[model samples]
Target: MTDANTTAFTNPSTFILLGIPGLEVAHVWISIPFCTMYVIAILGNFAILFIVKREPSLHGPMYYFLCMLAITDLVLSTSTLPKILAIFWFNSREIDFSACLTQMFFIHCFSEIESGIFAAMAFDRYVAICHPLRHSTILTNSLVMKIGLVILLRGSILILPCPLLARQWPYCRTNIIPHTQCENMYVVRLACADTRISSYYGLFVLYCRIGLDVSFIILSYIQILRAIFSLPTKDARLKTFGTCGSHICVILAFYIPTLFASLTSRFGHNLPRYFQVFISNVYLLVPPMLNPVIYGVRTKEIRNRLLRLFTHKGTKAFSSGVGPQTDLPGVAGW
Candidate 1:
């Protein structure tokens, strides 16, 4: 778009993302680690998905949210990884303007979905802890499906405009982007027209998203803590803490890196490019890799069920002379 509000990039076809700012290092160095992490992240999240889908004993509102969370992680990992890996491995970071818009759209959509899923998980944990008597009543199949639909609606409506607005912008200026992926603000800053409106809208979008999701998470925990402290038995208190602890850890791990990147960039703009890239990458890779482990490995019940599911599957396959993963255990309560 032109500076005076003219739609400059109206017919733009392609744009280029400058690979990771500046670091004379070879692309392979970046590609290897980045691709490795993406692979690990995808596999880890998918394993959790597999476990949840196969283990019937783990079927419940909690695991249902976990399934959604895993799906979010998968989408989040996939959205940016391919481009990132391509830029790093092949030294080709240029993407079509439309492709950039598509990447931006999916990134925002999935990240927003991630937050929405976390908020849903928080509510699930809160209900299990706070309203044990009515947890099932409140978290029925219909209610969970309704929440899922709300998440889909919110994500699609909030993020669809990003690509639409971006694509409509005129791009007579340089098509150079400083990052591998067309991150919302990064790509937005490249518009020939003033991006004040886009920035405001971006903040509004985030405000609505982060504001709503984080508020629900905090409020859920607030009531959860009150209920836990009000309980009499030490065993009761520990059990309550144990149940919520995994979720708390996962939330902190997910949110803190993001907060660090945002605050650091805001206050430390002078930080080197690789440093910024590294810090930003942490938020992407860490959560996907750690989430399933935090929720499954550290939790006893899910771990036991996972082990049974896998071991039983292996035994059945070996007995049948098929293969290790020939048959999966059915989902809980299925």
Candidate 2:
């Protein structure tokens, strides 16, 4: 209303993130669990990447797609958690305007890239199951490289406009973001100018880009299931199911919390602020923590490799002459 008030709002150089409102006093106490989870996510994903790189047996399409997924998870978690931890530990929540936009860009870009990787994984599964004889020929290293490029381009190009559009709108009232991260919608809501275009474009990207990928993933699974059921013996059916179980679990883990968080943010207007923030963290953090665990447990190769890794480390520490044992079940066989 007054020039003094307008100047006060527009002249602010940095925006403050109100990390988990009403729990400000317990920020330090609450950060312990989050710190532990972040460590696990980073270490677990990195281990997957390392195992795939070192093992010659894992140089196929499935494992390559997995490496891509691990990389995406690493980037996605790193983009959001550092600032959150800083807020909780050191009370550092001030982010410059351009810095905030940069954070927003990477957050959305890597999310889309992760979704695309999931779709690529689904297609790999489909080809392997539906056309076993042709799998190697169809999904060669060259094709994988091309697909990776397309996925990276799709996400980077589509997400570039989101922050660009948001930065054009001027903020004149408050710069306090309610969430820990600089999410696109949360940042756009702070703008005093019309934000209908930004809001609609965000929705468009969600439904058109991520939504299409999800649909194709479901369709690929359906076709794979059809092919598997046509096999003659029960043993064959069980073997096929075993091969796909880990991927199914990973897909469920990623999509369920994400959808729940999106719905809660949109429709749970009467819900407490902390509930919304909790779900948002769950959506962003849970996949990176759980994906490696699922793969290591369900996939025999990864589990054996991890076991050998630790065993070898232990042997070297205790005795220079002793070597790591390889008599574990599923180590010699597939």
Candidate 3:
């Protein structure tokens, strides 16, 4: 009888994604804001890439890292948003088994990579402020490339097991995922077989990667703050703090929603299902949408380059002696 029951297990070839449980009627209205944010995220991240690539002066470790970050945000958001929008708009909820696993992998993997990039950016700020003399020597372009490769490899390796483990589960239960996307835990819970192993493995990977990155980021900022305060003049101190302000804002924007969503998923089962769904969606949408905006508004170099890009006609008039010429060498054609 036991062997017969075990042999009776069947895995569905496709899973249906519920856009948001208990809010099916509002999917269209809800997609408006989500669609808006997704559009902004795409355009903003691409703009960052374009400006950084066009300007040679922005070719330092910081902007290089920013470019990598922009690319990561692009991929991270692109992975889930389009399918989510389709689910919302067309009520297209069916996802193939392999496709679901692929989506799961991309969402989690790039998120970890993005977190690592934040740590890298924090370290860049620390070196630039705390050890100005060594900043140039330490974070050369080649070294930054190596760091990026290591981050990519580490995140990919760590998250690869999640979907692989998930795929091994005997999902004899129903194939309906009660969320917009194939979130690891949500999908794993659909297995009729015991899922503690998969659940614990996912948790273990999350804590180890995110915890290590967070610790490194915190320590970097602590040393950076100390260095900022040690500056003799108030102006120097403020100026130094200003340099880190954008990165700090971006870090908070990224981590706060992520941590909240993570906690809500694990511990806030008593919370409203809709609220949990909302926060999970927010977690994926907000950072990518806000990151480029924060940097464009706060970072002088990037901001100025953006202004130059959009206002090149006015810049041309000014360069013709109608006003002061603020054009730099590499930015002439832009």
Candidate 4:
């Protein structure tokens, strides 16, 4: 490469993140909702973790996975939004190259971890419904810990190369990333070097790892549906479906916007830049915000626990003189 082509890599200092490129005038206004969503995501996920930890009855494979999911959501949102808000609020768009890469690594790693947790939760549901008698024996505490470890390891190891590959590239072109976050493709495209390998590897990781996880989740649901249908009573079917409803909502919330954003980035090349950035931001922010809401509303145990937590702070005893039910519907086998 020419001297000019090597300049950025040699004196790598900072990268500019273009927050909502064409909407510079509206960034302050736009930040209102973004800030709201960030607060909601943080508080919501924290509540999930708090509820799971405090409620002894929630100690099970399903709630264990829910805790993992909450942690992942917290990490994922925290990894991206602080920088985004800074850019929007203060126009502090320049990020150190190393810092940018580090942010990208964490963003991708936590995202993949969430995907894996979703798949694990689906399997938990499968075991609970399709093999109820074996559920306890199968998803013991040891197995839960092992699965969590495997999910963490899988994301951390696979995502290591993403930042490494970006660091190796000589970014001689303009160092402006046209999105709020340091997504892999956005950063790779700014490199002066040929990025075919990086692009292909990113696609490989997406399809092979996340794709595989999504497929397993789908298959688990299929088996779960079969088992639900096999039950003779309508009440059994409805109860089983109700047990899975929150999970289904969470899965759809996580994946649909992500798929839409991915497809638009790949194929909607002619679409307006601001629209693309909007969708990308939506993909990251919406899932974290919605997850806890879905669970709190759909899962009775979590809802009651959350209610009791708030109510207890106001009074010494229940107003109705009835304690919260300890034998609430279990998450896995309700």
Candidate 5:
């Protein structure tokens, strides 16, 4: 009996994704919202990129950071949504081992990249609000490009080891992943061999990237708030806060669920399987769908441009001086 049981388990070429485990019956129904969110994420992020690129007025550091964010959101959501939809719609649960690793890498790497972008955006807001006169000079085009490269490299370099380590493990137990997508720990936990190295390395990467990013973001915001309160009039403070509204919303949208999901995955071993899966999916899907909406609604510049685009008005050609400079001392054409 022991020999037969041992013989039944072997290294699998493909891993099976179980969509939602105990909630299998609701896969189709649950997919409707997931599919809707994915579509919105794609269209909304692309539209943001298009609007920012075409509207010369938005060629500032804030918008440039926003464009990076939109691009990251696009890659992050695209990495997993299609497979999730396939599992729900067509029952195509089998994912090649290589493909699963690739998906895991993109999902995690881009998530860290997205977090880094958020940190960059926070710095942009800090400079725009705290040192408005030096905003452009400090965040020059060259500096922005460098920041992007650093963010990309940080995420890729730190997360590269996760998949490489997972690849080295011997998965002789089972190939069935209970969640929808190939999360790092989920994949590593299936290994029949010692997983301590991979597990510790994952924690290290998480602290090195996300923990530091969050800390910096909080510091930036605190400094920004202090700067805002130093203004003499209530109206000035209010305007500055209004300018920061979109960014604060976007930051919360991305980090809250991400931190919750990560903590739950690490410590909530007693939680129901379906609940865990649902939260993980929400962490991936919610931010991308909401970011564009939050920015479009809260940012007057983007909103007006979007309205003009849909109204068939002729958009002025791209030019550095075309955008009208604002009168607010601490707000740089926000």
Candidate 6:
């Protein structure tokens, strides 16, 4: 056999992203459903961004964090969805090495952006709950912008090295990425160069940057709960914690699946493929869907604003048909 022919057959250029083994045609079957989710996630988060932007009253730290969250959701879903659909619907599973690296860069960058924003949200919540009087001074717009700058700086710095590590590999034949998108670990695994450095860096950044970020969030909440309980009135205490409950729920949703994915990849990559995709989807889509809901429920003002958007003009007609109704401005806003 010719050398070129041997190399061609043995050295894979790309792998079909056969999702979830044992679920026959896992690639084709998951395409329609997952694509639907991608659309919903993008639209839902965009709606939140639109509502926040148009509503003058939502110009606060919580809303600011919500905006950041919406953007991150778009970033992550964009990173994963197109490649997945290509694999499933069109039988177009091949991705150029450079495209894979590019996807990997954005995926890690945006995931860290979400993490960093959650930490910032926790700090914002701490100030708002623990020191209500200083909430304005503590979470000023300038300060919030600075926090955004930090997220940009930190997320870029953390994820830049992984792609650089990807490029160091000689690509000596193995190009099949096991998953749909170019996840960091899979890219590193395909590298022909020694991947010890890449593996160490990936884990190190995971533990130090994300681990430290989660620590700060938990610490902020601990202090916030203490302050909430020390308040003299039950109503005051409830009101204080209520302000941050949405944020708390969001943080939990974002962190748990990400942490689980990290741990599973480290130890259980051989586990069921369905499990991996399930975790990935939950982590990516749940936050985008829940962020709006959490804010609507906890803030009250956002909920009422949304209600007003739909029903305020129709109120007269509704009263004539179903009886009379009145919405106090304050209650309506909340």
TM-score of each: 0.86, 0.90, 0.91, 0.92, 0.94, 0.85
Candidate with maximal lDDT = 5
Which residue pairs in candidate 5 collide? none
Candidate 3 wrong stretches, greater than 4 Å: 1-9, 313-334
**Tens digits of lDDT, candidate 6, 60-134:** 766777788788888888877877777677767677667777888988888888889988888877776666667
148-260: candidate 3 lDDT, tens digit per residue: 99999988998999999889888885788889999998889888788898889888877865689999999998998897788888987876676778888888898889888
- Residue runs of model 4 more than 4 Å from their true location after superposition: 1-11, 313-334
Report the poorest 10 consecutive residues by lDDT, candidate 2: 325-334
Model 6: per-residue Cα lDDT at residue 247:
72
* Poorly placed runs, candidate 2 (over 4 Å): 1-7, 313-334
lDDT of 1 by residue, 260-283 (tens): 765554466778876776677778
| Candidate 5 to native Cα RMSD, angstroms | 2.8
- The C-alpha lDDT values of all candidates are 0.73, 0.81, 0.84, 0.83, 0.85, 0.72
Model 5 lDDT per residue over 231-283, tens place: 99999888778887887887888888887888888899999988989999998
Which is superior by lDDT, 2 or 4? 4
Kindly provide the TM-score of model 5 when superposed on the true structure, using C-alpha atoms: 0.94
Q: Poorest 10 consecutive residues of model 5 by lDDT?
A: 316-325
Pairs clashing in candidate 3? none
Instruction: Sort the candidates on TM-score, descending order.
Output: 5, 4, 3, 2, 1, 6
